[model samples]
Target chain A: MEKEVILQYLPLYREALLLTLRIGWQGVLLALVFGVACTWIRQLKIPVLKSLVTVYIELFRNTPLLVQLFFLYFALPKAGIRMTPELCGSLGLGLLGGAYMAETFRSGLESIAPIQEESALSLGMTSMQALRYVILPQAATYSISGIVANVIFLLKETSVFSVISLMDLMFTAKDLIGMYAKTLECLTLLVVFYLIMLLPVSVFGSWLERRMRRAEFGA
Target chain B: MKKNQLIAAAAAAVLGISLLSTGTVFADEAFRTLDEIKESGTINIGVFSDKSPFGYVDENGEYQGYDVYLAERLGEDLGVEINYVSTEAASRIEYLQTGKVDIILANFTVTEERAEEVDFALPYMNVALGVVSPDDAVVESLDDIGEDDQVIVISGTTAETYLVKNYPDIKLQKYDAYAEAKTALENGNAAAWANDNTEVIAFAIENEGFTVGIPSLGSADTIAPAVTKGNETLLDWLNEEIVALGEEQFFHADYEATLLDTYGADYEDTLVVEGGAVGTVETEAE
Candidate 1:
């Protein structure tokens, strides 16, 4: 693997990195909103909406993200939806990540003692106020690590968007290999590039986990 | 009543904006004409990014090849900035059909089914199926294909079509991109690789101990620039451009500049179609 080839294509990689982040993060933000909302709905146990949320979680989690992405991109266009590649990618990630995030948040929410909710109610707090103040704060602490892991996975999943022509980092690296036929060099560079992006997130995840642990345990 | 009318007008405006955002769903807006592309000051032309001697990028990261040279010429003649959209053999027609590219110069072979999906300009080059194998185990015919041995092909390519139709029993390893197909061939994962005759020949010449045993497998086909079906204005312009390009023997020049290293002088005249004007040699090269 030549350093020169990687260095020469740095500008191209930078451009692709911007595109990948744009696609991944837009999906990440949407997933965050969807995950939090769905968690609340699932916890509330509304009749029909709860069942619908169950279906979404099961469907997205069970199926491959690539298949979902392909459906959103290629299949929907046939039905006259005609979303652009970026929108399709972001939406796909949002739906897929939302499913996984819902489960993560569910576990965190489940881990909290039920007595906390009862205590808030005893103190004349509304269910909404109790959830927002007492339950949610603890759940956030419980699920911080899982949330970080999900976001990182979501970022990596955006690489598959290139199959639908979204031009993420993997797509650019594949194109470079196709152009130069330097498979090893370009792919090695891609590995390094992804590590560069994910390392900080992992480090911060551990730091946040430690801080959250200390806060919760009073240590 | 006035307040009601204002509310109705606001609703109508919202609906109109929503329609405008997803308006391309309508079939009419699925394709753009020459006028529209010219108005935009850029023409998105699909060309190969990895296939050497046709359309490939150089060490400088700039797109170059025989097809790239032609597309550049077309862009110059039309006075539009050519935004080169890299494409593969399987995706060329879809690229045009979906309006991702206004034109495709990606070593696209003129085929009846493809012609139904996209309009082809006059031929600029020629192609046929060719198979390359290791020198020790050269495959001269389909009969030479072993029961378990696989022939590697890039999906969506004519060579894949030819092989599947003629020799259904042969195990086939398919890849979508040239890099993967070539890598599969190099890895000895497959007995041989079959592709465009020009590509096979070039590959054999470039790589030692590889030979184009079946140099010509399918009927001769012409390579042409293609636009979306019914894109007559652009098609006519491209046809004219090809004719104009031929006046200077431009394809021969393209061959010398881009293809000479791989194909040499002997294959130049046979491979170059020269804008449908010169009909000298049949595409079957020995």
Candidate 2:
């Protein structure tokens, strides 16, 4: 309740807020690249590779992010590979997010009618060309919403990076609580920072969904 | 076509059944506190692998520190092979409770609440809550810290609990392990870091431009070896080991061997607890 207390802890919160944004943005970028690549691989219909992708998705998705993070940050070093906390957190989020996103994208690719691909092929388009011009254009609308959703998810998930000692928002909030012994204020600041990052993404997602609906219904 | 679909469906059903059964079988064989450990002939002792002078791995990738030294002694005393289970400050208790480790000797402070979930032996060492802050903007005392300032503390620590109870006005940032807490302090994410005085002092001495402020706080609590609750046999043996070790001032030797560098000339009397100096004797009846 004291103004002085809040005023004193402002720097910690500021730094934490920045860290959250940095990690969230980096995670989202990494997720997009991996997600797209994994989706492409699944589309290829390779005999054993498809099953391998399935296993990767199932393994990462079914397990808790905290456990995966511990494995990356703590266990891996003992096995002789060392990484900074930021690298560990970003890579972990990317790999996990990529699995979930691949499913979203696979569904998006399936939603496009076979007629589109067939038509592109008749026009002398190669498989990659058909995908790039015909399938992807149609799939983008459906995929956009999923991508936005995943970004938000990645943003929230980045909070767990604090477990490995990244100075992200949650870590800063916790530090603030310890320094001032004010749990409520620190938690409030954290919630507010999260909202600040996520609200725009949610709004953009809604706007994109509406635009896709308008395109579908010829509005 | 219909026959092929049927075959596929049957294969899917079999796979699903096997997956479901696998989970149950694995769960049924989950590690038991005593049986699995004894059969393996190696007792896993979880200790902090980053909190120096307690449990930290050195450059050689070997586990070293005061806790490691004590853990080696405990294994020798128990006549069991020792398998060091490196843990962070936050996961030490979880590691013990989940049977990942047979015992935890991670400079874990004994408290009434934690004692309910995990049994504690007689105190082997004593610890008090403390804080470390950057020397340039040092926190001389608890009152000097501002509300907006974040104090970093490792999660699941007595310092975290103490700050939450007594300094309810200050903001706390908690990391799950010492590695994270130290990084946060280094990155200026927190204005100060709080933990056991021994740890804070060690950190301050090792790193440049950090000083221990509020060097001691709350009540001085004993650090003891902990096992999962209901492991009376293991608990009994640990208490006996602590007493037997105390009789010969083994902890003093431990301090001299492992902690003397960190504490140096001035801190020997203040920081070191000679054996038999703290905690109650474990009687057979209770």
lDDT of 1 by residue, B1-286 (tens): 3355446545755565455435434422466788998899999999888899789988998999999999888888878999999997666765675688999989987776566556788888878889999998999997889998888877677777777678889876656678656755765657899999999998898888899999987888888888887788888888888888788989999999999988889998789877566475432221
TM-score of each: 0.56, 0.62
What is the C-alpha lDDT profile of model 2 across A1-219, one tens digit per residue?
Answer: 456766777787777767777767777787778888888788788979889888989998899888888888767766677776778888888888988888888888888889888989999999999987777766777788887888888888887777776778876765554333344455555655666667667777777776775434133
Docking class of 2: incorrect
Q: After superposition, which runs of candidate 1 have C-alpha atoms over 4 Å from their true positions?
A: A1-219, B1-29, B278-286
What is the Cα-based TM-score of model 1? 0.56
Give the runs in model 2 whose Cα sits over 4 Å from its true position. Answer: A1-137, A141-156, A164-219, B1-39, B274-276, B279-286
lDDT score, candidate 2, position B143: 90
Per-model DockQ: 0.04, 0.10
Best by lDDT: 1
